[model samples]
Target chain A: MNQQETGAGEIKISARDVQVHYGDNHALVDVSVDISDKMVTAFIGPSGCGKSTFLRCLNRMNDTIDGCRVEGDIRLDGEDIYAPEVDPVHLRARVGMVFQKPNPFPKSIYDNVAYGPRIHGLAKNRSELDEIVEKSLRRGAIWDEVKDRLDAPGTSLSGGQQQRLCIARAIATSPEVLLMDEPCSALDPIATAQIEELIDELRRQFCVIMVTHSMQQAARVSQRTAFFHLGQLVEYGETGQIFTNPSDPRTESYITGRIG
Target chain B: MLWLTFLIIVAAAALAYVLNLRAARRLWAEGARLHSITTFHALYALFLAALPAFVFVVLWLALSGPVIGALVLSGLPDEVRAGATAAQENLLLSEIRSLARGQAFGEPEPWKAAAAARLTALEATEGWARLALVSLIAAAGLIYARTRVSASFRARQRVERIINGLMVFCSLVAIFTTIGIVASLFVESMRFFARVPFFEFLFGTNWEPQIPIREDQVAGAGAFGWLPVLLGTMVITVVALVVALPIGLFSAIYLNEFASPRLRAVAKPVLEILAGVPTVVYGFFAVLVVAPALRQAGQALGVDVSPNTALAAGGTMGIMLIPFISSFTDDALSAVPRSLRDGSLALGATRGETVAKVLFPAAIPGIVGGVLLAVSRAIGETMIVVMAAGLIARMTINPLDSVTTVTVQIVTLLIGDTAFDNPKTLAAFALGMMLFLVTLGVNIVALRVVRKYRELYD
Candidate 1:
């Protein structure tokens, strides 16, 4: 629950005094946080609390939005992402993002998974590309259901399947970190539980940072949880400690269902 | 002319109002509330008086004012009775009214003076008639409303039915108009095919329609092998598409995907200005500037060129078509969901890559629709080709050579002095029917393609 920069492990992403403003409204204040390598960190807050904004900051997805200004420095493994030498295209390849809504490209499932790898030249031959596609789909854990009809449109699948396909597409390029923005908000309870379990399995390979409104989801899936409110990081600690034992008033209220 | 319908509506509305009033009052009386006459009885009396009273006054003002003046002009004393004949009385009244306005009547000085004197009296009578009409309607409406004061009325239901009827009438107008257009086109085209041999018109290679002037001489047999004209139309239309499709679609891509918001705001209106320009001006530009330029360019390239080459006409027509392609392309591109773009970008695809691979493929149906519509426009284009491309019947594919299109041939055939009874004049209708069918075919295909795209995405 305090400003502690613990550099005990190799940090994958580091932020220093990051501030974001959308038009005249300040979205993120003078704040700083660091993400450790190969771990799942969950962001929980009320709607419009800027948890999604901070998550998008990792890969510079905020660049797509007009009037959005990022003032502070963000670095991916020690390189300044905002510097003149950095190419956004190259940077996004290193860090991939999934949206709150499961948006699959209007193409076959095979094409959807292959789109990123093809553009980045990750595979040398068609056979290599095929292998990579199958591997990505297997890792994302929807291969058995979709393996029979790879030519079917990705949108034809159920919502849970589509979300998993998007995850597979994002990881096809072998990015170092994966960003998930409310990935379960559009899914049913069964789909949500499936995704929560998948997130747990995914943490063993990639550095995962997710934004969720469900406090129980954070407790069940994340090793560490960060609480955000009104564009400020109010608390960050072990999930069990934050949920049951000690935290700021806002974090306690939000966890106990008293306030958001 | 349909004024009687309004009277029927009014009667029905009055009946509804009365029923509501009676029902409401009955409920109130059950609760021991004292009331005036039941609403139905009051409304009934009001309508009985108001309908006749208002109609009576209106008829009086409309009919009697002029009649009275005409009676006075008949040169009888004021004590004389009015005539039984409506027409004679009306004539007399008009003359008297004219005289009162300080105009002299036809050739009798004493009679003109007498007519003018009576006209003044007729004006007062007309004014009274109008007053009586207004008072009668007002009194009737007031009395009917007063009767409802003591009872509830269902005004809402009556108004709703009238509104629903109006809605139905408006909807039918749209449906009937569509039916009318198709029927007319079908019948006219049928008449044209009957006069000319359908097989000869469709398959013949030559199209020279000249007929005889006098009965003693042999008539020039109208030759209409449509192959040349159809070929010419296809050639020019192809050239136009080649010129327009690239420039228009590229500009559309640039505007939609690359341009800043401020730049787009300016460029869109400027590009749309091409649509507002009259085709006649484009025709002149094709003839005066573009034709000469194409001839020079062709000569420089070591090729023989005609002054009215298909390339010149097609190129200018394509310029005219720029707005058509760009606007539709802009719509097609914009119609692709933003979420699709987001999905692509999040996976690290570059803008150019995303647009080429994902956006353009998704918008293919809409873009094809726009191109087909542009093809129809190019085929039907007359002014530019008439001025820039020559009127020859040669079937050639070379863009530098002078060519004639179906529309240009049609214009030339129908304009010069020609006998209407001969096959020469009627040939225009045959050509028109062909042009209509081509465009109709294109529209149907375009609509089907667009519909298929809609089903895929939605």
Candidate 2:
């Protein structure tokens, strides 16, 4: 387990010296890391620590931001995503993302889940689309509650249910990697528990990278934890060692709630 | 003299401000804590000094001319006063006024010369008297205001109350102006209805409002039916909407979703400038360019086109309206949260699909409200139709046929030397009343729809 950064799980994404500059401000500095597949890799730090910025970089989400410039190399499964030949629209379908807020489209619950599959031509007919929606909802652990009223607006759900719906929306694309940006920050304890359980179940199918503010969440749900502070990746190791025996003073100070 | 009086009032107010500022500062320094700030105390003193004097001066200026006229009228010779009728007396007064101005008309009475001299003396006295009174009132008001400025004086509260009253007055000014217009329209419409049956005017299709002005002139007993006029207005409105809706909506979509920041920065203001381009200019464009082009196109296509085609006016009006509809739609699109845009884009949906599927549906209420408001505007538009559309009251929907709209009819009926007592002139008022009601109804519904669904996204 201590042999290499890739270890046994197999590298899903490998990045070297990835620099993110938002206009004059250099937001992320020389971040180099290898993330394994079929596991939850958590990025944790205080606010404005570039944790979310790194998560967005995985899917090229930073392309949408004005004045944001990305430098260096980021590869998903030996393929450079930022290549000129690659379309962001096509790449986003392969790398799905869930935002911190439960931003369900102002549409019915069924339409919300079916949106990704429909756009990507995953369904051959109406019934196939319906099947995809039901399967996605079931996998999201929200089918039992929303099965009877798929016509209801996605925004009509509780905060926790909405987050789960967002998860369903993300996975409906059937991407290889799922990026979750503080998915539990807007939810209560129960909702957070449900999402944590879902994350564990989801690790079998997709490579998951999440940005979390709570150190406990990173420790509980993640096998690998990366600590970021002031746009720098200060530490990266096994979650247990990072929390119990941090190698960096900043990471130790942050974990003990001394400094952010 | 009036401006000099104004200068004195302003000087008095300034003096009051300076004096009260010193007084309030002394009170604060003497261990008596002030209730309001020093500037507010000074402003309060200024207002007290200026307001009453201003009111008195305005009243005195208004009353002095009439009072002086009455005095001059009474001073007329007994023979002239006793024999003259009211009209004759008014004539004599004007003649005397002109004589005082040294513009002596052809032969004048000797008593008029005496009266003009008296008028000059009275006018001079009136100016000096007003100035003296305004100074005295301002000085008294300043002294009284200064005496009232104690340590516990709530000068800020008083000044704030005055400000609140001024705001209320301004709002009432707008409300009352609207009410006055509606009331006058309604009253005049009722007068028109006394001569013509209300239902007949509303429902009858024949809208010939060309009644004979003189007994010898040959003219029909003008029918006041608004149906043809109303139908023509509808035709033009439909044509305008057809031309404007797609262009405006697509432009808004492109500007919001696809255009680069640099293009948007340059384009948005240019679009707004289109809105600011005077409607009269649009009218000229319709008459000088679009009308002639349509006629030639119609000739080439072997179709009969009127010189003043409704299509010409309606299409140019539509061009004029594009910026309005586009800006409104752009605002509604922008008002949708950035989170939704990010959500849709992150789903791998292209910008077009995202705007069409997610943002357009979300912003439908606002867009519909804007369209309805624009419809009302099209109905109320005057210059384009007056410049390009026909004056004939034809009951035809064909865009190529010459047709008259309500606004065009109103302009024609009101501009000439037609007597208001007849149905022809009164018909314009009736048409105006109808136009007002229809547009008012549309605007109300539009506003209500926007307000009702505006909170759903939030």
Candidate 3:
């Protein structure tokens, strides 16, 4: 299969000259990319390389941070998301996020998956709510392990299970786009593999964007990968090409482990 | 003279420190890799030399006066000793002391003058003996410490162990003091129970405690049923909590979750300043401001209001406790992980919904613990009630009505000239015992809830 053409859909999000500042620090400088609807696009970089900061900008999650300022044209389906008329709260429902740490609301496993759906009023009745929870859990690929113990507290699950539960919660709102920030970094290799497979399967339905520290994980899971360094998007293209024939010397050095 | 003695002992200790410090350095220079640092060796030497001498001097100072007085009193003329009570003996000794210090008026009696001379001689001898003994002990300790400062001596370990023991002793002081207070309260309550039937005291509804001090005066058989007093406490506590809990909790939620950082920084300290305002000041506000305002409002509304009402006291107390509850709740809500908050927001939940569904559940244990602890405080509040509430113990739960709480009744029963063994005074201890037990129970439950639920959230 040609990796660049694999399951690629219409452009769901577009960014041009996107810059972010935290207080006086210019954190992400002029990042521009197009995120397709039905593909896994990965952001890979060293620590503090601003990949996570750019990922946070997609749903206006940076608004929650004090002293954080974002300036650029960022749009969802050609609609400017940073327009004054847009409410970040509603924007978040369309662009859901999963964090590095598994943070389930200290509630039952059933409630954890149902949290987003219930909050957004996606389900009109109890059975609809139950159905949504079941679908989300199944989509998260942990339904078989947790279906019998839905009433158990979400925090009682192991680290990997909790991450999956968080994923289920994010997806329950039926978001058009999903942003994951190092979701599998805290998990074991086996768990990371399971999540990688789940991410691969998820790309057929929604736009899946992720920031990953591991270049190997990016090579394995992402259809397209963007390399970032020192607040700049150094190179972006098909994952195979970026790994095999990066245009920029900096990108090549980063891939070759000579400099971060 | 005592100050002079203390100064001498301190100087000796300082000298020992300097001497050891120099000696250790010389040994180190001579190529001995001492097990501990030079400073530790110096500190160890200083402590060993000074501590024993300091203790000896303090003990000697405390004992010398009593010992000399006993010697003089023993040599008192037989006529002065015969049939003299303890107070009289004390008077005679004081007279002798005053004469010896040349502060006595008029010519002293022959026996007193003779006693004064004897006291002076004993005191002089004792002072010299203490100085000599302290110096000898300090020198002996200093020399012994100097000899022990070898390569093998772990001065640091020894110093650390001593410091650890001192810390344990300090902590034990707090524990022992608490035990002592509880022991005294228990013993006094036991004495009261011996005189009054325990069940009657527990179950009685009436609470008049006016036992006349004079034998000729007439008074009631002193109804000590504590129910009315306990009821008064419950009513005020309810009123205070009613006024405090919702306002406090909401303010905490607003300050923690909704307020801008600049606004919270300014407002939180201002709220905490309300807590620092003395309860006595709150008492005055209840008596001088709230009471009158309540009465006027009642008149405007065509409702009855007492001049000294539970509402005035309880409401003012609630104002005083607002910061208490808010700060506690603030701590609890903030303690919820930021990642959980971000996760909720990322799920498209509004901030309000996020707090209502996720943060509240996570922080519920801490909030409940804080409320219970605050409730216990309200139950034990005294100054506001004493200043604004009625002295008569009425069982009414109405906030507008005059009432007396357990604390107020305790204050009234024990004030002025009253014998300890009498039921009126003894009743105070019994009431106190109940207050202590109730608050202790609330505190324990609050702590347990906080601990048990913290594990799940954290």
Candidate 1, residue B43: Cα displacement in angstroms equals: 19
Model 3 per-residue lDDT tens digits across residues A31-79: 9998887889999988999999999999999999999999999999999
The C-alpha TM-scores of every prediction are: 0.78, 0.91, 0.95
Which 10-residue window of candidate 2 chain B scores lowest in summed lDDT?
A: B449-458
lDDT scores for all predictions? 0.80, 0.91, 0.90
Candidate 2, pairs of clashing residues: none
lDDT of 1 by residue, B1-458 (tens): 12442454355446545654565566666884434345444454445435555566557657875576545645665443354467765665566567787776466457556667766766666665455555556456545554544333443443455457669978998999977876765665566567777898888888776666467767566677788888888888999999999999999999999999999999999999998999899999998999999878888999899989889889999999999999999999999888788778878888898899789878888898999899999989888888887887777888888888889888887886766555666676667777888998998998998889766655
Q: DockQ scores for all the models shown?
A: 0.49, 0.61, 0.78
Q: After superposition, how far is residue B254 of candidate 2 from its true place, in Å?
A: 1.4
TM-score-wise, the better of 1 and 3 is 3
lDDT tens readout by residue for model 1, A197-239: 8888777778889999998898899878888899998888778
- Indicate the DockQ of the complex predicted as candidate 1: 0.49
How many angstroms is residue B37 displaced in model 2 relative to the true structure, after the best TM-score fit? 1.7
lDDT (Cα) of model 2: 0.91
Kindly list the per-residue Cα lDDT of model 2 for residues B1-458, writing each as its tens digit: 98999999999999999999999998888889888988898999899899899989989988998899989999988988997888888888898999999998787788999999999999999999999999999999899989978888899999999789879989999999999999999998999999999999999999988888778889887888899999999999999999999999999989888899999999888888989888899999999999999999999999999999989999998987888789889989998888788888888988888988899989988898889988999999999899989998989999988899999999999986788788788888999999999999999999888777665544
Ranked by lDDT from best down, the candidates are 2, 3, 1
